[model samples]
Target: MTEIKRPTWAISNPLMQQYYDTQWGIELHDERALFEMLCLETYQAGLSWQTVLNKRSAFEDAFHHYEIEQVAQMTETQIAPQLKNEKIIRNRLKLNATVNNARTIVKLHVAGRTFDDYIWQFVDYQPQRLVIQKDENLPAQTRLSVQVSKQMKKDGFKFVGPVTIYSYLLAVGVVNARLD
Candidate 1:
C-alpha cells in the first residue's frame, strides 16, 4: 500500500498546523465543546494560535476539562497556581478572563440558553462559507463578529473582542472558510 500526503493550511508555526488539521473549522454542536473552544479562543487574544495549540492539553487539565460549572465556581486562589504553570500561557489577565467567562457561561445556562444558541443566532444558525485561496486573505474580524462581540461583552463575557470572537466563529464552524 502507498501512503498519501494530506493537504493542510500553512500557518506561522507547526502547532498552528496541528490545530488546523485537528480542530479548526470543524462543526461542533455540543455545549461543553463549544465552551472549551470559546475559552481557548479568548486566551488566544494577543497571541498566536500556535501558542494556544501547544498548551491545549495543559489548559484542558488546568481548567478541569472546561467544565462550565466547575470553572465558574473557581476562585482567584484556585487560578493563581496556573499563572506559574509552564504548560499553558502564563498571562494572569487571560487566566482571569477565562474564569470570568466561565461564570457568564453558567449564567447563560441558567437563563435556559446555551452559548451555542446565542452565538449561532447571530448567523441564523448557518456557517458563513468563504472562498479563500490563501490564508493571508482570511480576515481578522468582520461585521458579524463585531456585533457578536458587543453582545457577548454586554452579557458579561470577558476577552471577547471582535478579533477573538471572529477566531472563535471560524474555529467552531460558524464561519467556514473552505476553498470550493
Candidate 2:
C-alpha cells in the first residue's frame, strides 16, 4: 500500500483528512444534509472549524439530529437552556439563528424547493472548482456569495453574510479549491 499526503490545512487525523478529501469538494444534494451543513456553518462563525468538527455529534443531538421541522418549531423557552449545554456553541445569536434558519428551510420546502436546490441554484448547480496551491489563496468572499447573502437576508434568514455564505458554499461543496 502507498501513503498519500494531503494539503497542510487538512488536519492530520485520518477521519478529518478523509472528510476533507472525500466530502469537502463533492456536491451534496440531500435537503436534510444541506440544512445541517448550513446550520453548522452558521454556528462556525468566529470559531475554529476543529471546534465545530469536534462537537458535531453533540450538535446533532441537541438540534434533534438536525430535523428541520423539530428545530423550526423550537421556541426561545425551549432553546434557551441549550445555551448552558457544553455540547454546542453557547452563543445566543447563533442558537437563535439555527432555529430561524430552520423555519426558512421549511418555508423553502413548502415552496416545493429543497434547501439544496435553493442553494445550489446560486451556482447554477455546478461546483466552482479552483486551482490553488495554498489555503491563503482561497477567498473569503465572492460576488456570488454576496448576492446569495443579500437574497437570504431578504428572505429573512439570519447569520448570513458574504463571508458566511462563502463559508457555507465551501462547506457544502459548491466551491472546490483543490491544488492540481
Candidate 3:
C-alpha cells in the first residue's frame, strides 16, 4: 500500500484534509458557491481557515445558504440576531459585509453579468496551476489578487482585500497553489 503525499498544511486537520482533497483547487463556476467562499474568506480575515470551515454550516444556515438574493434581502432585523449566535464568527461587520457582498452579486446579475463570468475573466476562464514546492512557498497575495480586490471594492463589494481575494481565488480554483 502506498500513502498519498499531501501538503503539510492540508494534513494537520481532518476538515482541512477533506477540503483539500475534495474542494481545494477545483474549478467552481456556481455563483452561489462563489459568494459563499467570498463571505467565508471575509470572515477568515484575522482568523484561521479552520475556524471558518468549522463554522461554515452555521454561516450557511444563518445566511440562507449563501443564496445571493436571499442574503441580499436580509434586513438588519434579520441580521441582528446573528451577532449573538455562538455557532458562527458573530462579527457584526463581517456579517453585514456578507449581505452587502451578496447585494453586489445580485446587482451584477441585474446588469446581465454573471458572477461566474466576472470572476473567471480574471483568469481567462482557465485555472492556473502554479509550481509550489512546499506549503511555505504559497504566496499570501499575488498581483492578480490585488487587481481583483481593487475591482471588487470598486464594484461595491466589502471586506475584499488582496489577501482575502487571494484566498478566494485559490478556493474557487482561479489559481491553483497545490504543491507539485
lDDT of 1 by residue, 1-180 (tens): 543222344355676666666677777688889999998988788876777777889999999999889999999899999999999998888899888988998898899998889889998988888656653467889999999999999999888999999989988989987444
The TM-scores of all predictions, comma-separated, are 0.89, 0.92, 0.95
Misplaced by over 4 Å in model 1 are 1-15
Better of 1 and 2 by lDDT: 2
| True-structure RMSD, every candidate | 2.8, 1.9, 1.6
Q: What does candidate 2's lDDT look like per residue over 90-172, in tens digits?
A: 99999999999999988988999888888888889889886677545578899989999999999989999899889888877
Q: Which residue runs does candidate 3 get wrong by more than 4 Å? A: 1-4
Backbone clashes (count) for model 2: 0
The candidate maximizing TM-score is: 3
Stronger candidate by TM-score (1 vs 3): 3
Maximum-lDDT candidate: 3
Pull out the clashing pairs in model 3: none
> Best to worst by lDDT, what's the order?
3, 2, 1
TM-score of candidate 3 on Cα atoms, chains taken together:
0.95
